[model samples]
Target: MTDLATPGSAGLLNGKRLLITGVLSDMSIAFQVARIAQEQGAEIVLTSFGRALPITEEMTRLLPAPAPVIRLDVTRPEDLERLPLEVTRHLGALDGIMHSIAYAPPGALGGRFLDTPWQDAATALHVSAFSLQALTASCADVLEDGASVVGLDFDASLAWPGYDWMGVSKAALEAVARYLALYLAERHIRVNLVAAGMIRTVAARAIPNTDHLETIWRNRPPLSWDVSDPTPPARACILLLSDWLSATTGEILHVDGGLHAVMT
Candidate 1:
């Protein structure tokens, strides 16, 4: 409840209700999305799980308006089952969902692709890739028609030095999004992803050779890429979450400062 300035007039998501997940800190892209969503007049509920719940609750205090933090571990079926009830209690039906959750066990990341065990890889796939479907399905009862589902992504088109299984998971995530978009189309619910460039978030830092990944951005993108700013990608998420992209689904919006388009 740190009362920041509200937007002067109706903003992009004015009067919309949103469910934003994976907001662990101020540096989190999800955190920036929540802040901007509030400025744009969207009512948002954030989700964290287990040990991260308290941290996310603290982060909510930094938003323009007070947002309730709900416990949701996408890997846990019990938590998924309670999601609709929890969302209904807070914001009734949802207009949009920001699925920013992603994780891979240490064994599955950092150049261990060949050495990574099946259990570790499976964990990565479940939490990082499959959670998108699980999350959307869990909230199906609460999501309104024409609702948007936007997930955060890194460019999964190529193999990087240390991304390893997480990269595989991201590739799987893209497929999941496309399938979700196709299925949810019947309900007019748009599902898309924003493939962002590397930013220095806690999760990004955990990956070995992140500097090499950042170096690629610095050298290749026609438009300059800022590793410190989450604003560009966050804004992309906002646009996808808004009705402006009502006709767009099963798409991947690149917010990587033109890097994804470069030949190098």
Candidate 2:
């Protein structure tokens, strides 16, 4: 569902281009962003990895028009090195990047933090936290002067029932966003995060007892909460990426139906 008020020319993202990662299915937050961004006149591309490539290629075929899917497994040096070149080849210079990638090994979640191994912890940090920095640095040269960088986040302020290492990874992700915002200010680039509430995405499915977390939100949020829909958070991301938020950076804009602001 798009707002009809937006013009064909003054599209929220006219002439702007964005690269979105972590789009595995139509229910993905990245998928929502890609759809809306294109509807608003932004050129877009998707990135996938390894055996997941065919899945991404299949998904893109569902879009209104076909868009390129580039290879990017953030931890792989070669993939990161070629990302900018690949995007430029398909979509020209980047005006925005969506760091929607994050992962944690099975052993790292659903237990005491102390039980987590360094290897698993390190994997979480690299994929969930450091990937943001890697994506930004790799594409920095091609990023337009007022480029915006956005990532999907879940609040890491406290421990959760089964989030374990992923909770820690989220904390690191937040810090990385702030540091990037500070450092990239000189380049007229903005870095920010949308700390969205849990939605039933493929990534969220990895978290143990995620449905319990969603059930809790149904009764607690100030505004209505919908665990099934990620469009609200997706739209919020487009706002932060657009020129409308030129002055906003290093901020965590919560799109959790106001849950993060209230206390029981």
Candidate 3:
């Protein structure tokens, strides 16, 4: 295994034990973070679900080291209940947890926000927002002192062409993090979100007109963007999970290539 330097000392996450979710493919931001975290000497345990377990297991081998996998379908009560023990069996205690999971039903995207069903919208909010809290609750005991919780998000202050319900989900996710920040602070645990620009992934492919949006980002962003790369945001997640951001909590760190600040 590759060894990383300690936080400001350089090995940022050295000797940390982190739990990462939502790694469906190599293009996933969580996958990249897991890779870099391991390179920096952190031990990682991954979470996946039923049919997707095999895929995530395959992807885990691509990390800097082979990681143990735990089953976690946030939508299921049983899975969440079992996750803690399953993870502990692999790694004694976790120093950090990364929430890279988000989902919405098919009709939640595209140009049909008004046509989207309540069930789908509810699913989005639950998976994208509430699950953060749920995961935190389940993993709280295992979290070492001064632990950190990191989540992936998109800027949700405005509407985007095809993001519809998922945009709503992200906004809710931001608020959820803030609330988690308040509750976990007394325990010396921090919670934060990273608002990243659009990146091509299995999840992004579900959004309609991604190509058109990519073209817009290419011309509009002051810093160039690569839709295929999620490493930038992944690194940002690593910093938040490390001691470098000890005082930072309930905040949104933008890793969008400065797209949020540039004026069209």
Q: Evaluated with lDDT, which candidate comes out highest?
A: 1
Clashes of each: 0, 0, 9
Model 2, span 1-264: residue lDDT tens? 555323235578887889999888898999888877877778889999898889989998777667899988899999989987898798789999998999999989877578888999999999999999999999988999889999999988878888999999999999999999999999889999999987999989988888789887798888998888989999999999899999999999999888888895
For model 1, residues 200-243, the per-residue Cα lDDT tens digits are 88889888898898888788899988888888899899999999
Poorest lDDT segment (10 consecutive residues) of candidate 3:
1-10
TM-score head-to-head 2 vs 3, winner: 2
TM-score for each of the candidates: 0.96, 0.96, 0.95
Candidate 1 backbone collisions, by pair = none
Give the root-mean-square deviation of each candidate in angstroms: 2.5, 1.5, 2.6
Model 1 vs truth, CA RMSD: 2.5
Q: What overall lDDT goes with each candidate model?
A: 0.91, 0.89, 0.89
lDDT for position 192 in model 3: 95
- The list of candidate 3 runs beyond 4 A from truth reads 1-10
Candidate 3, residues 139-185, lDDT tens digits: the string is 88788879999999999988998899999999999999999999888
Kindly provide the TM-score of model 1 when superposed on the true structure, using C-alpha atoms.
0.96
Which of 1 and 3 is ahead in TM-score? 1
Candidate 1 lowest-lDDT run of ten = 1-10
